[model samples]
Target: MQNRALAAATFSFVVAQSLCGTLADADWPQWRGPSRNGHSPDTGLMESWPDGGPKQLWIYKNAGKGYAGPAISQGALYTMGTQGEKSTLISLDANTGKERWTTEIGDILGNGWGDGPRGTPSVDGDRVYAMNGGGHLVCASTQDGSILWHKSMSEFGGKTPNWGYTESVVVDGDKILATPGGEKGTVIALNKETGSLIWQSSDITDNAHYSTMVPANIQGQWQYVQRTEKSIFGIHAENGSVLWKTDFPGRTAVIPTPIVFGNRVYVTAGYGTGCKAVEINEKMEVKELYSNRLMKNHHGGAIQVGGHVFGYSDGVGWLCQDLESGEEVWSEKRALGKGAIGMADGKLICVDEGSGKVMLIDASTEGFKEHGSFTLDPQSEIRASRGKIWTHPVVINGKLYLRDQDLVYCYQVQ
Candidate 1:
């Protein structure tokens, strides 16, 4: 009887351990969360902020400056910044905000807009991927921040964009995809383990811009969609074949990544440019459904939830537009000035650009409903002379993560 009881307890322990492992694997492993659409599968998050906003759990001052955001996975947070002239990648303990390790990858390049690294580090399983403004792509180990492999975009026949490599590397299956923007090809897929070029998109060569690659299945086929200065192209994810192309009259700069929903794609850019919704047919043909300047989302990417797309539309203010017709449902320029935004539990988390105030609003088509607002007190040292809060806010596992240059503040949203 005693032996049987002990056997039953051991079996239950093994089952519970396996369940926890599976849950941890479902975390936000890379940029834009698990789906690369800025949506977190994390539930049980605080639906409303406290009166003065949730308590700041901790702040790590070692993180340098630039607009790069934090990538959380396996109990660790990865982000990039610059100290002096060298660009460094730092990893931190997600629960305690303690430094795990830091690695100097390359030199820092500055533009009129900002400085340091502008792209988020992608944490893939055992490897952490980061890109510097100087066009250096480094893949390091998650355990100790040791360099696994490194490659330069310029050396691989890609030119650095005006604002640097702001596109976060996308890891799909065994390959990592990036836009180098040169003669080799606009998009290239590299072996995630060995860092060798597996394939490059054929001669649709155009200069790289600020957008990241988004993976989606359109009409039962897997495709990688990206927007460049010239046009938007959907490439076959398996072999990098140009599936379809649509000309976008983007002016000055094209920064935001295209949002894909089913067979339709929505794209937007700032600086007098506008937004458009395009449909992809079964034969790989592109047709514009609606094009308008109503929601000119600058560099901040919009999210499609329910039936409306929510984002800050350049000079038009924070707006929600119909997913099919491109009609504005509501515009709230008076509520929150111009800035980037993200969605958490069906709520719009808006970060004001001019000021460091974060606002929570209802993500609805009815109108703008402000729930709570608070200024990010005790800002980072590196953010003293920097531009507005440029990094998009991220919410995961009931925690709110915001960045100002190198400093990252983690708050308990629940």
Candidate 2:
């Protein structure tokens, strides 16, 4: 009898663990996963791929694209695209890659590099938020494609950046924050429910750039960190007060989001701008630790794991640097050439910009190690002219999600 009771207890524990794993795999929620950093806490994924790579689960044509990645929430996938002259926000079935709904949000702005919406959509609990290329911001219901509230940055005394508003809205608690650059405010906090202004940053009045805001707990205080053309600053999460400012000599554009580890923050930009690490003191004052040009990431953000930072260096190829001293650890220029990156299960999902080839590499401080790769053959009927596969790949729920113009592809990674 004693042996039978012990066996029953072990069986119950295994069942409970399986249920907990299923619950954690259901959502991707925001721009860069749950923490707003490009890291997914998923396990049980295939560590290596076969010769032809993982099998494509499904592909949805006419999804449109302009470098906007997908935001998965609940059981739906949200992203933005451009159809002719109109900008659209689309929701797709997460499992099958079928279109659930598409809504015309605003007109598209033609740019030199490409066109269409450039920012990733952000989905809260019940509402989906998207910003268009022309500065039109809309909040729509996640269940159905219904607009809840809409506002344009121009109407709020704001002007669009040269490249467009590429920063995904950062939702903190009950407030939504955006960079509406102008005299009114650089960063505006609005009530998530009613779309009313709660507070605005009054310290610096500068035009918006292409970087997104990252939430960080610096020295035991929560703050929002953002980088613009001139500098990088931290604002209080509770009230939008300027906590600290560090002047960075950003040239053509400062596009990459900053990464914070412990009490130090690391920021990088392209077009001659390099990377820097700044230390935050107890009083919210920032001091420069070291600055170097080892990594000049343009817009594709960087991620930190262990004690190294991994990202694409503008002229040096994909590189890794020591997070503390800004020292170059290893640099590899062979696989995936030059492009954006995403991380999942201790591996790097790199998408080559010139060719639509995706490669999986081990995220290591030693050197680059390729485990698998596949060339994406997007259907000719749904391809874009100028912008190919500029959007970054997102891995979640044991699947790899990628976008190329109007086509969104999902492949089973496990």
Candidate 3:
């Protein structure tokens, strides 16, 4: 009788463990969340923190060495990192800091700033898609550390950019899109299931940049919009034909993903590149609305709420920029230092890259308002001395996830 009771208890525990990361309702299945806009659809979150910060649920210190954030899906948290020579994909129990599995994708792609993977894995039903620093794209099983198929971006005549391959491959229905920057083809789509070539942006052969592409629906027509070093353009989703292109000279490196709202597409870069918004019509014509040094977001990613965009703008600090007009609503440097940002439930979640300071602020066009803030303890000491906390904060399923190289923190914000 005692043995039977113990067996039943063990089975019950297994069932509960299996249900942890599978809650698709609030899962962050891809980069920049489900919409790729850095906005979480979660609600009922705490309007303000009590004191230090929301309760730190747990911290997984063995996240390996990487600056990438976690992608939560199906009761699991998916991410990548490196130990020594191998850059690997790691899956963890979302509710706990325990690692479920790890798969070696390839050798570590060394970089001056940091090493290991930079792109977050895009999780689909049972599979997760990710790109390594060496420009290898792998489609693997989310259930276990098993590779279904792997392909190198160089196979399509694409070369790694200065900062490495950081663009999270955009996955649409039945297809996966990636940029192999160079004269060969800027953007290429492949069969998400079989890894077969679908089409490449043949006419527009520009080198790949470090920004993720966003899917746009212009007047009921389907298209993909992206920003490169030299230009911002849109391509047909079906055939990968260039629909419209506009030259916007980008300085240094253009890291932020292009923002799309209604018919307007906005692009911004660091090193005084500033910001530019262009309007595209259904006729595939492009016209510039405004360009200025208002929100020169380096990489922390700006989020659009209502009619305002919020991000950590260089020089100007955390800024709120108007979407329709390229004007600064407000800029506050005292609230937080320049870092990666995210949004959920009408609040801005920002982490200072230099210091491990995490802040929660009101996402308002009126001005910068702080609710509460806290500094990350037990941060990654293994990180490089010159390294900054470059990983963007991700909030999903009423929880907040942030990374400092190998250290991953989970907090209850709701």
Residue 381's C-alpha lDDT in candidate 1? Answer: 58
Q: Once model 1 is optimally superposed onto the true structure by TM-score, how far is the C-alpha of residue 233 displaced, in angstroms?
A: 0.4
Q: Per-residue lDDT for 356 in model 2?
A: 80
Per-residue lDDT of candidate 2, residues 1-414 (tens digit):
999999999899988888776754467877888887799867888999999889999988876657788999877999998777899999999989888999989999778777888888888888999998888889999988899998888866788888788888888889888898888768888888888889888776788898889988999999899878988898888888889999888898888888888888889999978999999999988899999888899766788888898989988989988998999999988766778889999999988877888899989986999999998876334444555566888988888998877778999997
Candidate 2, run of 10 with poorest lDDT: 379-388
Per-residue CA lDDT of model 1 for 1-414, tens digit only, reads 999999999999999999777655556767778888888676666767778888899988877768888899978888998888889999888878999999998998777767889888898778999898878999999999999999998866888887788889988899889989877788989999988998888667888898998999999999899989879999888888899999999987898878898899989999878888899999989989998898888866788887789999877888989998899898888887888788888787889887778998888888999888888877765564547688998888778888887678998876
lDDT of 2: 0.85
lDDT measured at residue 144 in model 3 versus the true structure, 0 to 100: 89
- Tens-digit per-residue lDDT, 129-168, candidate 3: 9999888899999988799999899988899898888988
Q: What value does the lDDT take at residue 204 in candidate 3?
A: 91
Lowest lDDT block of 10, candidate 1? 379-388
Backbone clashes counted, model 3: 8
Clash list (residue pairs), candidate 1? 63-406, 64-406, 65-406
Scored by CA lDDT, what does every candidate get?
Answer: 0.85, 0.85, 0.88
C-alpha RMSD values across all candidates: 2.4, 2.2, 5.7
